[model samples]
Target: MMRVGIDIGGTKTQAVALADSGEIAASVTLPTMRGEDAVLATTTSSVVALAATAGRELGEFSSIGIGIPGHVDRVGGRVRNAVNLGVRSLELGPALRERFGIPVEIDNDVTAAAAGAAHLMSLSGTVAFLNLGTGLAAGIVVDGVAWRGQAGAAGEIGHLPVDPHGLECPCGQRGCLETIASGAGLRRAWPAGGAHPGRGLVRAMESGDADARRAFEGLVSGAAGCVRILALSIDPQTIVIGGGLSRLGEPLRQALGATLREWSGTSPFIADLKLPERVQFLPENTPAAAVGAALVSRT
Candidate 1:
């Protein structure tokens, strides 16, 4: 049986139908609507539309899954603190299950993406997916299963305190990794404020702007810190980096490699682990979260 997966983000919602053979049979993207009710309505409609687009009926789907941007109570099928979605508390899973009369699963978007990465990469053993999107987070998968931790906060690496005197984070903390390493962090750290500060900073740095170079250096250092933390803690088989900043591509990986080299030279343990070589990039068009949601429906 095919499965329906939905990835709900702040700006847009994506739906995909995964055939029994693990192929994407159909997919659709739509602007995310505002308000709790509208968002729920849109999600249901989008999944049905994807199924139809795949030339299949809703009854053909065995399960439905959704990746939401918030703290999810997997046991209770509820979500909270999803500020971008303008939802404080939502019983999304039960609502969708009732609407479609099928089993439904809900999880953090990044966690779902990690599952997708593991599937896409065909990785085994332990793997960590470092998401450098608007926020920073890491998703851990062990032997093909997502490890959500004791409280579903397992992969919240962004909130890890990295600096004692760094900028304050929306999570009511200072020096969180997100403030230094994420795309949003890079934009906020830019010396010149603008509509697209991160891109502007990168451009300026490429054009030989000293200040932009310094800013990027700091951002690169933060990213390295994230990798080091993941490496020392989980020692996963590989680290898959994805998200919006992934567009930076080689430049980003080069920065990460340089930092890892510096640390490896200073510490024998770092050199022995060879963490830099384990880092890899996700494909440009991979719908990690949506595909992951479909994969998780069975679990």
Candidate 2:
């Protein structure tokens, strides 16, 4: 049976249809609509359109899976505190299941992405997907299965308060890791009037600007801290980095590696683990979460 997966991101929503063999039959991306109802409507329509594009009726697909931001209550089929999508609280799984007339599975976007990455890489054992996007989070997969913790909030490393006196996060916490490690956090470090804040900051850093370098270093440190926590806590075979900041590509990895080396030089345990070597980056076009969403329905 065919499976459909939808990723509801902060700015864009993507839908993909996968055949029984795990090949993508069709996919579509649309700007995420504003407001609660519109967002739900857009997601539903996107899935339907993707199925039509594959020349298959909705009934042909056996199940649907969706990945959305913020806290999710899987059993209740409700989403809470999805600030980026502007959805405070919404009942998504039940609504979509009713509309599509199929079984639906909804999960945190980062978790879904982690599952997708594991599936695509054919990874086994423990693997952690650290998503550094508009927000920060990690998704853990054990033995090829996603682990959401008891409260379905397992990988919320973004809220792992790093600094007691740091910037306030939307989650009503001060100095959460997200404030220092995420794309949103990076932008906050830029000048108020800087054009193309992210690129501009990178350019400034490349030009030997002291302040820029400091900002960049902070990002590297935040990222390294995340890796350390994951390594010491889960010791995953691989820690895959994804999301918007992952676009920083090799540079991000290099900086992270440097920090890990610094720590490893001081601590024999860190040196033994070689956490830097375990880190990997996804290809720019691999929609692991969306793909994982499809995989979820089948599982």
For residues 62-107, write the lDDT of model 1, one tens digit per residue: 8988888878877677888788888888888899889889999998
Cα TM-score of candidate 2: 0.93
Error of 1 at 32 (Å): 1.4
Model 2 spans > 4 angstroms off: 164-174, 193-196
For residues 1-299, write the lDDT of model 2, one tens digit per residue. 68998899888899998888878889999899767898899998898798779998888988888898877886777888888788988899899988989988888888889989988887888889999887788999887688888887787888888888889987898988888887778777755415334556666778887766766777788889999989888889999998887887777778889899999999998899988889988878887988988886556
**How high is the CA lDDT of each candidate model?**
0.84, 0.84
Query: What's model 2's overall lDDT?
Result: 0.84
Model 1 has an lDDT value of 0.84
lDDT of 2 at 88: 89
